[model samples]
Target: MTNSIIKSLSLPAPEEIEVAIRGQRALATYLSTRLETQKIAIQDADNNTHQIELPTSALTLLMTILGELAAGNAVQIVPVHAELTTQEAANILNVSRPHLVKLLEDGALPFHKTGRHRRVLFADLMKFKDQRDTNSQKAMQELSDLSQEIGLY
Candidate 1:
């Protein structure tokens, strides 16, 4: 998602964020504690009402996503099977277009040729990004441990 879109999704004020956070937390707590309250009520702007039931796992995931948004974090929901252009994928990864192309060429990321252009699947991109993030975290942790052992931390 573009920064402008993300900015637009951001909470208008800190107080709104706080209120949203609390509301999500409260709903989560209530639903978890009250087993009888299986379905949630959804009200539309037109005053229409809908109710849907969710599994506990799904409810937990919803709560987490809402919590992140309520904390003023920009969240983008993309379909797993979505295909993205090279520039869009690079933007998501916060990398240069050339670097992304290099990765695709080097077999670091999988892509398919659409005519003359490369198209990357959202799922594959996410898998690669998750692996890279895990590796970076591991390296950082090792460095911190080494520093601690040497009395530098």
Candidate 2:
């Protein structure tokens, strides 16, 4: 995806948050069943009703997007196979571009050079992020345990 599209994912407005709350509730009602596909009827602004079949996976994704919007969070949907610039990857990781470059140089993250610029696979970036988060959580838990053992808590 283009940087413009990524940058455009701002927090939903108050009106949109209300709409997302309602929409998420409505959509979540259909997920109670273990069906492979869901048939949903939606009314348009003109009051015309149309039925559409949505895969369960797509329905779940929509629910997640709506949930984030309802909570006033910005969401960006990136394809797994997409190649992102270093800056874009840094933005996603909430880290500085220089830090990300250092990680790449240290072989902590996998990246490939496209022409003179470095490109990171979205999937690879996610994997690295997940690992980093897991490590952070583990360290936090260890610290908490140590504090408790030392009567610091």
Candidate 3:
């Protein structure tokens, strides 16, 4: 099944950033141990309290989100197994949609056809991106070494 569409999130306000900073600090304190699960007590605006057990992994993810919010960044979570549209994949790579399509046609990236639409697995796309980034870094390093050898760097 197709995953839900990605939604744009607005930047956090000053007050929200402050709250996120506090929340991230509070959450970080609980992550010092190697516990599989943690029991947390939460209070609502109406003064109602609830206790819930959450996986440590989930808590760490929450802490990361809070840290991003504290830094005034907007964040979105995508499942690794989700299928992404060409446009969405392009957005993630900061590339144009036509370039993404060309890459797909050239076999630089893997995709499957759903009827007539092409869908890229998020995991495959990420793997391709990581490789591309590594290649770029290697090329830059080579260029820098060449420049240094020529006494121009």
Candidate 4:
């Protein structure tokens, strides 16, 4: 049980670690240290271990997650018109602000400048991504059909 607990805590990704803990009663029970401001400890069914404590790092992450939840994210679940400044648009595209501006100037994304700073609508961004996906799928299908037609598959 100690070996498994150690293995799970040492997992590379926090999500995978949390999943391992939740899936294994023993793993959850092996947690040994946490700060006072950390989350309340939860016990597994048929409790056999009570001396264990959740790690402070894990608890801090959980607290941040709780904060995010409380900050209201359900409203952002659906794509809608979101007026975004240049910096925000850059973040959405995973590009530098200047590069995003260049794309905007090249008519890549439907955007407008408000007194020098540019703004984008979230709906337009979603449509752009959708079109890209559609085109990519169509191209892939064409390639697959060609390969089969040529007896390559």
lDDT of each: 0.80, 0.89, 0.91, 0.60
Q: Count clashes in each candidate, considering only residues at least 3 apart in sequence or on different chains.
A: 0, 0, 0, 1
Report the lDDT tens digits of candidate 4 across residue range 47-137: 7444545557665555444344444321123236557776766766677999888878999889876677677877887787788789999
In angstroms, how far off is 99's CA in candidate 2?
Answer: 0.9
Question: In model 3, which regions exceed 4 Å deviation?
Answer: 1-4
Q: Using Cα atoms with residue i matched to residue i, what is each candidate's TM-score against the true structure? A: 0.73, 0.90, 0.93, 0.44
Query: How do the residues 47-126 of candidate 2 rate in per-residue lDDT, one tens digit apiece?
Result: 99999998888889999999999999988888898888898989889999999999999999999997898989999999
Q: In candidate 3, what are the lDDT values of residues 1-153, reduced to their tens digit? A: 275446667899999999999999988877745888989999999989999999999999999899999999998888888999988899889999999999999999999999998899999999999999999999999999999999996
Candidate 3's displacement at residue 150, Å, is 0.8
User: What is the full ranking by TM-score, best candidate first?
Assistant: 3, 2, 1, 4
TM-score of 4: 0.44
- The lDDT of model 3 is 0.91
Q: For candidate 1, lDDT tens digit of each residue in 81-149? A: 878888888988999999999999999999999789898888999999999999999999999999999
Rank by lDDT, descending? 3, 2, 1, 4
- After superposing all C-alphas onto the true structure, candidate 1 shows an RMSD in angstroms of 4.2
Relative to the unseen true structure, what is the C-alpha lDDT of residue 65 in candidate 1, on a scale of 0 to 100?
Answer: 72
- Give candidate 4 misplaced runs (Cα > 4 Å): 1-79, 94-99
Q: How close is candidate 1 to the true structure, as a TM-score?
A: 0.73
Instruction: Flag the better candidate by lDDT, 1 or 3.
Output: 3
Error of 4 at 49 (Å): 34
- What is candidate 3's CA lDDT for residue 86? 89
